[model samples]
Target: MSRIGKKPVELPSGVEATVSGQTIEVKGPKGTRSFKATDDVTFSVENNAITVTPRGKSKRARQQWGMSRSMVENLVTGVTTGFKKELEINGVGYRATMQGDKVLKLALGYSHDVNFEVPEGVTVTAPKQTEIIVEGIDQQLVGQVAANIREWRAPEPYKGKGIKYKGEYIFRKEGKKK
Candidate 1:
């Protein structure tokens, strides 16, 4: 028995979960999310809780069982409480701002400014000139957007001039002496 798979997901208030065939849909005040289970994975909701079970003993089946369960649980939680990712800009003259219509324009000490268009269902906010916050109900989409933004200018090991997670740690490397 899988420890994580055995644990039941508790349904929060104002959240409704439904299971149909291999698909599970969760609706909440924030939004609605759905996940499709694999062939060997099954899920059911009982007493405001959700459970996952595997249909076969194969390795793939076991893997899918756990993955599907976790995905469904994340979907439920995301819709209820949502998810957030924070990014910070480093280096002199490096900053970020939200442009019109889900577009984020960034200045990372480059020759030209970079423009990143945010995906639907994801909200991007800039509290300060260098701090960025991304929120959404979909975990996958949230993460992908964060990654894409981070990719614009990953922190360098020498000066660390770029974009990075708010609290992420980056090991500094020694610069070569001229």
Candidate 2:
């Protein structure tokens, strides 16, 4: 009865999927990814699509069946098209630039500039010195890299100066009176 679980995942062209024991491997033009299925879940590939089913009628088995299937679908899509996160720097003098391999230099009104290294499989791009783009095949890694970069200069409540996701809302707080 899982809405998402009932939908079969379509396999894209040039992507290969193989199931061995409890492991599922998906390979595509971008890269290869693998995931381990839970004991109570079952999976099969047919007609260029992947389907998942729960092995029992228990609630826990049903819950894990949908979750595991969604995760596997995400992995397949990620390896093929990849994922991306965009961030913007607000406030005067706050900027970012690529320093070197796996390194990003940020200037955010701090005494010392912040340096962050891009993790493997993730790419960071600063197109306008104030706008950043993070891309990768793994959704978790992309989000984590964006969070780490944002932590260097979190948006302030009063001035809203710092790194933030594009289109994200920031609530401004009133400043103290002089």
lDDT of 1 at 168: 95
Model 1, residue 70: what's the lDDT? 87
lDDT by residue for model 1 (1-178), tens:
6777778888988999988998899999998999888789788899999999999899888888777778988998798889999999998999998887688989987799999988889999887989999999998889999999999899999988899998999999997899
RMSD of 1: 1.2
Model 1 poorest ten-residue lDDT run: 1-10
Model 2 whole-model lDDT (C-alpha atoms): 0.91
What TM-score does prediction 2 earn?
0.96
lDDT, candidates in the order shown? 0.89, 0.91
Expressed as tens digits, the lDDT of each residue in 9-90 for candidate 2 is 8998999899997889999999989999888888899999999989889998899888988999888889899999999999
Alpha-carbon runs more than 4 Å astray in model 2: none
Using lDDT as the measure, which candidate wins? 2
- In candidate 1, stretches whose alpha carbon ends up further than 4 angstroms from where it belongs are none
* Candidate 1 colliding pairs: none
